[model samples]
Structure formats: C-alpha cells, structure tokens
Target: MTRLRWCLLAIATLLASVLAVPPASAAQDPAPILDPIPDDPAPSGLGLVLQEVARLPKSEPSAPPTDPRLVRWNRINHVGELPDGSGRLYVPDLNGKLYFLDKKTRTPSVYLDVKATFDPDFFSAAGLGQGFGFVAFHPDFKRNGKFYTAHVEAGNALTTKTPDLTPQPKTGFHGVIDEWTATDPKAGTFSGTHREILRIGFSGRIHNVQQIDFNPNARRGDADYGKLYLAVGDGGNGNVGDNGGDPQNLAVPQGKILRIDPSGTNSANGKYGIPADNPFAGQAGKVGEIYAYGMRDPHRFSWDTGGSHRMFLAHIGEHEIESIHQIDAGSNLGWSEREGAFTFRKDDRCHLYPLPADDAKYGYDYPVAAYDHDPPANWDCASDTGHAISGGYVYRGKLPALRGKYLFTDIVDGRLFYTNEREMKQDPTGQKRAQIYQLAAYDTAGNPVTMKQLAGDNRVDLRYGSDAKGELYLLAKANGKIWKIVGTKQYAGCKPGPKRVSHVAAAKNWAPVTPSKWRFPGREVILAEEGVQRPGPRRPFEYAVLKSGPVFASARIDAEVRLDTPVEISNRDVIIVFGYRDDTHFYYAHLSSDNTIYPHNGIFVVNGADRLRIDQQWNANRSHGAPPAITDEKWHGVRVTHCAGTGEIAVYVDGGARPVMTALDTTFGSGRVGFGSFDNIGRLRDLTVRGTPAE
Candidate 1:
C-alpha cells in the first residue's frame, strides 16, 4: 500500500483505543502501586452536615498580643461533658477561662476562670496549646465533686516553684496538673479549691502537656476506672539534634502516656499514685508512671466505647507524617527513630526509609491510619500541608450513618477523614494500612464547603469533641465557633463524566512552540530535536497546544506517549499540557523515568510567573516524591483530568485506578490541550480529549 494509505488505516485503529474502555482481557494488568491517599478522594454515599451550635465569647490573651493569630479572639482548645448530670457541655479556651454551655440552649457561661481560680501566671500564652490545656471530670463527679485540669506556667513559676517530679531537667516552662474539689456538686459555677497533683519542666513553650482524660469505657468497679492518662509531648526536645533520644528514653515522662490515680498518694511526690499495672511501673531505670513511650506529640486520645473499647491516639508528626495509632500497655510509637511505619533519621529530615530487617524485634507499634503532608501545591502561603491530626471518636450515637466509623481531622487544614473501626487495626506482618476516606462536610443550608472555607482562614486550628452520648462536635480557633454533626447528607463530590468528542489525527491539530524542531510524520507528533533551554523552575522548553478542538472549561485527555531518547539516558521526559491560555500559563505533567528530582517526574503549572509544582506527590525537600513518570522507551497509556470549577487536577498512568500526580488550581481555565517534551525528543499518538466546551 502507498505510505499515505497506510497512515490512514493506522489512524483508524488508534482512535478506537484512545478514548474507549477496552475489554478486561485485552492484556495483563500492570503491577500494583502503593498509594496512601487514593486518586479518588471524593466522598460518596453519606456525608455529614455541620450546624453552628455556639458562638463562644472571646477571652482576652494573658500577654500583650504581638500577632492576631497568636492571640485569636477565642482559643477554644477542647469540648466534652463533665459527667455531672447537668445536661451541659464544657469547653476550655487557651486564653484562660473554662466555659460551660447548656446543650439545649447552646448558651455559654464561665465555668472556671483559670487565671482567677489559680493565678495569672498559670495562663501561658506562649503557645496555642499551652494555657488551660485540658480538663477531665471524675467518673463520680455528682458525688465527689472532683475534676482534673492541666495548664502551663512560665516566668516566676519556673524559678520559685519546683516540678512535682524531682531531679528533672531545668527548663523554660512547667506543665502543671491540678485536682479541684467543687464546693457543691450541683453548682452552676466552680467555687472550689484546687491542689497541685503533678508538674514537669519542659524544654520549650511548644508541645507541652496536651491532654489528660479517664477511660470512660472502664466501669466504676474496674481496675482501670478513675486512672487518668496524661499525654506529654517531647517538649520540642526530639526535634533538636542530640536530644532526639528523649522521647524513646523511658526514664523521663516528657514523651509518654502516664497512667496515675488521682486519689491515691503513693507517687514519688506523694501526690498521685502510679498504677502498678503500668508496663514500666516496676522497671528499674524506667519511670513508674509511663504507660507508653516514644511519641512526638500524642495530641489527643480517645477510647471507642463499642468495639473492643480500643484506645487510639493521634500523634502530630514533625516532618511529613500525621498519624493515628492504637495504644496498648507498653506500646512504643517510634518518633524521632520512626515516623509512621517508615524509618527516620534526624540527619535526613526530608525522606523516609524502609524499616530495618530487625524492625519486628523492636516491638514498635505503627500507625493503623496515617497521611503525609501533601507538599504545598502552589508553593504559596495560601495553603498548608496537612498539620496536626485532631483525634476523635468512633461514633456510637443515634446517627446510624456515622456509627462504626472513626472520625478525625487535620487540625490546620480542617480536612475531615475516617476509617472503619474494624479496619483500624495494626497488621502484625506490617504489610497493610487501614483504608482512610474523606468525609465530606456541608453547611447548615446543605451547601458543600470545607472547614477552611467556613472558618475563613488558611489555618483552621480545628479540634474535635464528643459529649457523654458520643455525638461529635467540631471546634475551630479561627472563628471561635462550635459546630455539631446534626444529620447526614449525600456527599456532592466530583462526578465528572466528560463526554468524549475530540481526537487528533493530522498536523493541523497541534500548534508547536518551536515549529522548526518538530515534524508531523503520518499520525504522530515527533519532536525531531530538543527545544531551546529556558530559565525557570518547572516550565518546559518546547511544547504544543491542541488548538483545533473546542474550547474546554474542564477536560480529560488520554494519549500514548514514547520517549524518543535512548533508555539509558537519565532525566528523559515528555510533558502533557492543558488549560493553556498562552505559552507561560498552563498545567503540564512532566512524564520522566527519573523518580529522584524535585523538578522532574511530576506535575507543573505556569501562571504569569515561573512554573510551580502543584502535584499531590511532590516532596519539596526530597526527590522521592512520586513514582517514575515512565521507566522505558516503550509506549504507555496516560490520562489527565482537570476540573476548572473545583480546581481539581489528577494524572493517572497505565490506566491505574489511582492518580500518581494530583493538584488543585483554577489559574487558567477554558484553554487548549496537547503534548510535547521539555528538552528531550518524544512521540505522541492516539490522542483523544473529552471535555465540556466553554460557553
């Protein structure tokens, strides 16, 4: 056949495979890829609605505010019931006061003024989680009229007063826990006397004592009943080079969960009793009160009342991981030594390594549910990588839709997530992770929104709460507002079903940046030579836009790409472009064989400024962000989806169910789409795009 006639027959075969779903038996499946955050994060089925239950009164900061965010209008840190049978809920504002609100009326009043109840020095504003740290009432609060609280103190308290635990580090601040007796059990306000039960010095103002709570699952007659668990962080000591051993050292209480009896007086200081059942209670060189060790910040912990009554703690990670782990006696969650299940070395803060072969012998429990910080997509201050896991409860409430799922949040981003109670268990073989899914949030009017949008701040500073009945509440420091999970709504997540309508077959379909370096041979786009070098971060040197098709507001593009460069060459790549307003403004997926380079093997976008990486899997400090874009010279299937309305972008390789590269941006919508290489030669064929045309 003639060359022209042969090309026409090949083009007919290419169009059929580009946009259609082939039969399952078409070929063998590719190797399975490991992804912690799935490509499809949009929630399906039932979602939750948030209703404004209370607008908390603002408490003045103890110190002069140098920054508004440092001293928010109200710094509400926690919410829970006191078990006092008052049908009331209590929340503590880090600024100073503890407020109580009638659940029915949703009106709040001062329960106890920590600055007034103790001293002004007791209310530390040095950090957000410092003052009025946490509160826990006695299981029999209606009779004993007793409760517990934790707070931080600076200045004179660090010099004049001594920590309850003697022979400790001389530090900058003190974490104090006090036991208070109410004058009347049924009183509306606290008119009581408090005595110091425990105190420890901390290395810095941040990551001090975060929480103190009792096991609600333990009955009154149970041995575990009334034992208070204190979550003390590493006092910012672990982040410092040599002091990384502090959290793993059992001798100190700095990075441990300590179980103590509030009424007994057998501790070293004769204030609280150290439970003999504690794993290290009788160990020679270990602190008798340490229940579990090796945690950076055991920010918040809770017990699921229904299933095995398992206790879980949400640990805020330093560099990348934010995780949730199931806690048991003597459990050690490796911190500076391990972040999540991966090996961590203080010298290399940017990467995670596989655990050593003898990892099982160390008896370190890993996270059942975890997520790493998705690198700052826009490289701007407007967004934050996930920060601080706000631990929450496994719902046992009347809402059937929410029950059995353990709900939680990223405190900074206010992103809500959940995992099944049964699936949230550690794998003895360390080969599996619990499936975590996003739980969509909606406004009271049933309009979908994010916690960050509702709070109107980049840093939501979100926290979770549960009343005695197990219903959940979401509190944000940004707005000083409390929202309750009132009912269920169907999550209105991205259901993009773009209609396939366009394909490329001839030279007229593409507009190349450097026409001299490219040639259209038959049905393929061939970059015969490398394009000109450019001075920018992630922008490519040469590329082409599919200018002949309909204008698209959002699109899903598919193509078969092959690197024309030799397989032995490193950094060989082909970039696929979309949303192209001009040469400098568009999004591109840098498909390359190299997995170890910040600027290669992921997604990039240029909007008037130099190109910036906005992919979900691009690590800023390290190179091992995403998998290799392509590892060989052979042709492979590629897919790119962009939704302009929601600013969601995803890239799938080899027809994988999950995207290896994803991003969110709406910079240049309603543009064109095409493919080319940054500096290397490549070939593109079987091109197809399905999208909604812009009006």
Candidate 2:
C-alpha cells in the first residue's frame, strides 16, 4: 500500500472520534458569491464595560529603531493567566519583559526579561511581527512548572542553530518557540530551565510567528490534551509578495496552523510528537505538523470554552477583508487563493472577486464570520488603514451582554467589533456568513469613549487577554494601558413614548443657549454670527441646542439649512440636536464638508464630557467615491430620526431615502430638538419638530 493511503487507513478509526470534516463535493460552489462585506447595521445597545487596569511605563528602546512598529509607547501584546489557580496574570512586552500582574492589587512587576536572562541577541529593534509575541501555559503548569513562549531572534543566529523548518532560501529572521520549566510555579519572578523546542525561519519579518497556544478547553484525557498550535505566517510570501504557492504548499510549516504533541517524541525534531490522529500525521510528502494550511497572518485563535468548542482563528487580510475562520482538522483556509469568502486576485490586490466554478476541487475553507476594511472605515487597500484584526474569545464570561458573543477589534484603529457566536456558521457556498456588529464603549464615569480617545493616540495597537474564568481584557501598545471588561453599559434608555406632537415656526418659543449669537431672520432662525462676538460668559461654539417646541423621548427634526460661508472651508458643519437632556448631555448629527477626519461628518453624543462618535458610516468612502454629507455652500434638506426604545438614530441628507449617517446610542432620551452650526454662519428654515412629549 502507498505510504499516504497506509497512514490514512491507520488513523481512520482515531479520526472518527477526534476530527470530523465534511467530505469535499462538487455541489460546494453552485452559485459563487462575491460582494463587499455588509456595513454593520444598528448600534448594539450593548457596549463594553471598561475599567482601568495598570499602565506600563514607556519602554525606550536601547537604540533607535527605524521601523514604525518598533517606535511605540510600549510593545505589549499578549495578556495571559498562569495555568495555576493563584490568580496571577502575565503580560508580555515585545521590548523583552514579561510582567506579572497581581489580580487583587492590579499591579504589574517584571517576571522575566528575554534580553537580560535568556538571550542577549533577542531582536526586537524592528519588524512588526518581531520580538516576544505570545505565551501559553501548559494545562499541567501548576504541577510541572511548564509554559511556552514565542520570540524573535536575529538572522545571525542562523549560523549557530538549526531550524526545524526553513521554507525560504534567504532568511531574514527566526521565530523561536521555547519550553520553560519554572523552579517554583507560584513565584512572582521566573527562575527556570529553558530549552529550544522549535525554530522556524522566515524570509521576512512581518507575519512570521503571530500566536502560539494550547486548547484551553482540552482536558487531560481529551484527544487534544497536550497539542501546541502555532499560527505560523507565510513569511510575507502570500501577502506582500502576492505569491500564494508557499502557503498552499503542504511540505513546509509556513502559513499554516501547526499542531504537535509538545511532550511526545516521534517527529523529526524529537522534541514534539505528531498526534497519531492528525489528518496528515504520517502522510507522504506532507508535513506531519500541519493542522491546517493556507493562511496569511492568523493573528490570534481561541476555542469557545463552552458550546461546540470549535477553534476559531482571526486572520489579518492582505487587502480588503479581516476574517475569523472555523478551523477543522485538514482544513485549508484559502489565502492568496481567497480572502475571506471572496476569491483573491493577487495581481489585482485592490479588489476581491467571486470564487471560481471549480472552487470545490481545492477544498478551501472560508471564514464563518468576517468583516471588511471599507464602508465602516473607507480605507484604501494599499495603505495602513483599518487593516488588522485581533482575535478575541467566544465570551463565555458572566457579563450578560458580552456572553455568547465573539468579541474582536481592529488592531490599529481600536474599534471594538463582535459577531454573535450562534451566528458563526461555515457555508460551503459563500452566501450566508455571520454579520459583524459594533458595540458601544463607555468609561467608568459612564461617558462614551473610543480607544483612540482613551489612549490619546490614533493607533491603539490593540490585543486581547482573558482570565481563567474566561473574562476578557483589552491591552493596547499605544499608551501601555490595559482595560478590563467589567460589565455592560447601555448609554441610552430603551423606553419608547411621547404621543405625537408637532410644532412649527414661532420665534418667541425658541430658546438658544446664546440668544445674542443667533438671529430670527423672518421665518428663518439664523446663527447669523459666530460665538466669537460674545467674549463674556464665553459660551462654547460647540453646538446649538434649541430646547423650544416639543420635548421628546423619541424625536424627529426636519429642516432646510444653508451655510452662508464660502466653500473654501474644510471643517464647517451643521449640527442637528435631539435627545437633549440638558446643556451637559444629548445627541447630535454633525454634517460636515470633510468625512475623512475622525470627528467630522457623523453622529455623536456628549455624555457630560467631550463628544464621542456613535456613527457606523463614519467615512463610507474615500477616492472610490461616496460624498461627504454636506460640502457645498447651498441649502440641503436634512432629517434626523431617533427611536428611543431601540436607540436607533439615522440622519438623512438632501431627502435621500437612506441615512447618510447612522448611530446607536441611549445616552439620553426624550429631550428637545434644535439646530445650529459648529463653525461659520448657518440658517435653519422650514423647521419642524414632531415627537411624543417626554414623560
């Protein structure tokens, strides 16, 4: 018998119990689907309950590094709990220190330093994927003092050590995986014996070794017990080089999820064993270590502690899509061949096309839940806009709002995103994957905030961490800060009311914060002058809220506005106010000339502090087309409709049937409606307000 057929036969009984995947059939791609990922619709009343955790001091590099990723506030990535029940948490910095955090006190102390103790030649000076990337504790760590880590080393080290797998001829760096046994597992600082277990050479630094983990759900007697899964990237082949051959190749470990028994010995390395039931364990000409192949950068992966216990890996895409694939034994996540559910045309890197008619012949796997980098972001495929996807857990925590949801985020923009766990399903045809959604975020003071706002940096460089109980935490490299997900907070109340009431055009009934700055020009109310005229009391030129007419819990404002200022201005905007509780809080639709800037052309909420954006279609388009809400000097018909119970707010421009902007927020309910401009003179005419009066 052939070696491949013999190996398959030997593991057939074992495979039935350990792995089950659908057999490949011609019916897989009857109707290929190729469509831009849908924009997240409706604000989830649910938002993250973020409580401040410890902040690490900025780590200045010993020498200046030219690469942008190396010049960060701090380079911390992974936040993990030690396998022991001591409640100790360990966070690693790419600059070389492993910090041990105290759960009770919420303090951090250095637990280990790679450069000082392990290897001085640790190369963390440059490269996005270089340095201490990930760490995982063995399930038996409490008893064995065993844990594993993946770190980067300089290419010069290639002279002394031999790599287990070297896919490329010319190597740029090495991603090393090591096994360490601590003298005292419960100790604060690490004092241990370490040995190199596996080393993989990469031709490029980016997307080298992104994550290393164990099946946290697998118990001692389970079939997956001691298997270590390494998310090895394509060595920058399939992504930047636009060459998919290496990842699609089965002979090498690059661009593959490799699974091996860390404690067993039977493989070529003699340090790890290939599980007997591994789909390709002893298959001919194929690497036994590969669990699944064809990936770009499998940034992170996790197993749902409860439910189906299926493995999910968040993949950072080369162009448009950022995806999370449901991994199965012998599965191939088509990378250069496919990006998410769409067929990837490597030569045409900017666009994604439909899968080919014979897609089933390749037996590729598509993401169960995926999202794109545009519409919600308006990012170009070539640049560093909203591209990375940091994987998060299928929350099995007690937080009612976050539970049963797979929470994730954009690594660069710090936008929090999630997909319903119940909705993630693998479809042979690329038609019905889960729709991704955005959850609102508020601080301890109950004011809405974005990661960019909290970190004071545009690039949050985000990552996720979890406790033994499955609760998650947000870690950022931008400000070296960590925030724990404490509970849930809905910014607005969902009680709908206020019977139909309408009022129109009565100058005497209008109430503006600065009556002097506004003028009643016949039938039109003109913010005829800027706030600069009044120096005394110094009324902020922020937004004009007219609390006259009818107060509402649910409200609608239809108005015609004309900016008297010339079109030369880049930041001029008109604001429509609703859900106004008082001067301190309310919601507003900011229609501006520029949509690319973060603060302009969107819906926002002022919850006592500064205004926070709540709009999903913040920048729906750039050079590829969609226009900003209002960019001309002429009059535009605008409408703002808010539903109190559902916290749905949509703003339409120029009588368009669909909202130019949309946001979900419950920060305030049942308040007055009004109009004004942020900067420059604007007049609101033909104004009408209709709503049920606030109870």
Q: Tell me how far candidate 2 lies from the true structure as C-alpha RMSD in angstroms.
A: 14.2
Q: Which one wins on lDDT?
A: 1
Could you tell me the lDDT of residue 693 within candidate 2?
75
Write candidate 1's Cα lDDT for 1-695 as tens digits: 69989999899878877758666645443322223233222333346889989979977667776555565657898889879767799998887788999868979999898876657567565665778889999999899999988988877887788886532355888899999999897877899789999998887777889999999999988999999999998887665654557888887888889899998888988998988889988788889999988898899999999977999999988666788899999989987788888777666545566676678888888998887765543434233344778898889998988889889988988888888889888975455667666666777776667898888788898999999899999999888999999987643234334556455656777788888888888778888898877765447888878777677877888888989899888889999988888777788888889867777887788887777888756655444556787888899899888877766677878987556676667777767887888779998888888888877
lDDT of 2 by residue, 1-695 (tens): 69999899879977885556554553353333323674443345567878988898678543578867667888889787888898888898887788989979879999888756546557777777778878888999999999888988874586777678745657767888989999999888899899888998888768888888889888889999878999999888655453447788888888999998889889897987889888888988888899998898889999999988989999998767888889999888887688887887656756777777778887788888877766334445566654589988999989887778899988998988888888999987766788676677778866667889887788889888999999899989888999999978653433334444334445675677677777775777788776443333222364456645457877777889887777886678778888877766777887778766766778888777777778766543432212477778888999888877556776778887446666767778678776766667788878766666766
Best by TM-score: 2
Write down the lDDT of every candidate, Cα atoms only. 0.80, 0.77
As for candidate 1, its clashing pairs are: none
The CA-based lDDT of model 1 is what? 0.80
Q: Please, what is the TM-score per model?
A: 0.70, 0.73
